[model samples]
Target: MIDKVAWLHLHQGQVLSTRSRGKDRYYLPGGKREPGETDAQTLVREIEEELTVALDPASLAYAGTFEAPAHGHPAGVRVRMTCYWAPRYTGTVQPAAEIAEVAWLTYRHRPQVSAVDQSIFDWLHDQHLLAE
Candidate 1:
């Protein structure tokens, strides 16, 4: 299955994350795409809905895509995560809607994230963007 996600970097060397409502682990601040939505559309909409920030369409960069076993899904099911990196942004971030808590995460605390998010953390670390 396809899952569209976004990775927002803060000026403090931390990445934005959300504790999904009722979930134990934290995740990147994004969600699945709705019908008739393009990847960019989904990313922009999801981030706005979850973070209450406006994403500049031109600033969104395609980082990379990752795949892993879907969380809370039947065994053998996988999720293909299309992740993007937005190095610049506008507006303050806040937890909205289904998001219970919002925080910035550093590489030292990467293990606290979900499996999919761990993959993202590794990628960012490899790119030398994550703080050691």
Candidate 2:
């Protein structure tokens, strides 16, 4: 199993997503936590690295957690994604590091993301936080 953290940045009913270099699917802008890092710490670092933005730790709140079959992995390999929402941040958002593209995605884009991300889309849509 793999563990990962993600940031849920919503704007105008769309969620920010990123596509890594050489990858086909788009994903939320955060990554896995390093050893000894809390979820907020990991979120801030990963978001800065990937999106060139600093997520204010004080503005972080739990969104939800999801589990699904790991994309492009062997059967039974799973990934657990814990997500957070940040209401404030600094800097412009641009693709950085391994990110090749940044997109604002809605429920219609569900099939273009990974399994776990699809679940997030569902939740956001149900809550009317994501556009149809």
Candidate 3:
């Protein structure tokens, strides 16, 4: 299983998502942890690399975890995604590095995300954080 992390930034009932270069599906921001890095460190670095923003470690809060078959992987390959919400951050979020596009998505956009991200959308909708 591949372990990954994601950032959840919600605004006006929509969630921030990103599509990487050459990728067809949009995903929550953030990425895999580097060796010897903590989740907070991973999140801060990944968000900066992908979003051109600085994630406030103090604002990090555990959101939820979701797992599903890894997209574009062989059978039996799975990804475990641990998500966090950072309400306090600095700079304007813009696509950077490999991020091809940045979007604010509602629950109605579920089909455009990965399976693990779809689960996140479901949970967010159930929590009333995502507009129907």
On lDDT, the candidate that comes out on top is: 3
Q: TM-score of every model? A: 0.90, 0.98, 0.98
Give the C-alpha lDDT of model 1.
0.80
Off by over 4 Å in 3: none
Q: What tens digits encode model 2's per-residue C-alpha lDDT throughout 14-100?
A: 999999999989888888889999998889999999999998899999989999998988999999999999989999999999999
Q: Which ten residues in a row have the lowest lDDT in candidate 1?
A: 2-11
Show where candidate 2 strays beyond 4 Å. Answer: none
Report the candidate with higher TM-score, 1 versus 3: 3
**Displacement of the residue 119 alpha carbon in candidate 2, Å:** 0.5
Q: Candidate 3, 101: how far from true, in Å?
A: 0.1
RMSD of 2: 0.6
Model 3, C-alpha of 109: deviation from truth (Å): 0.6
lDDT of 3 by residue, 1-132 (tens): 999999999999999999999999999999999999999999999999999999889999999999998887899999899999999999999999999999999999999999899999999999999997
lDDT (C-alpha) at residue 49 in model 3: 96
Write the residue-wise lDDT of candidate 1 on 1-132 in tens digits.
Answer: 747666656556678788988888888888888889887888889888888888887888887888877777788877777877776668878999899999888898787887778888888888787777
Count backbone clashes in candidate 2: 0
Q: Work out how many backbone clashes candidate 3 has.
A: 0
In candidate 3, position 122 carries an lDDT of: 98
Candidate 1's C-alpha runs over 4 A off are none
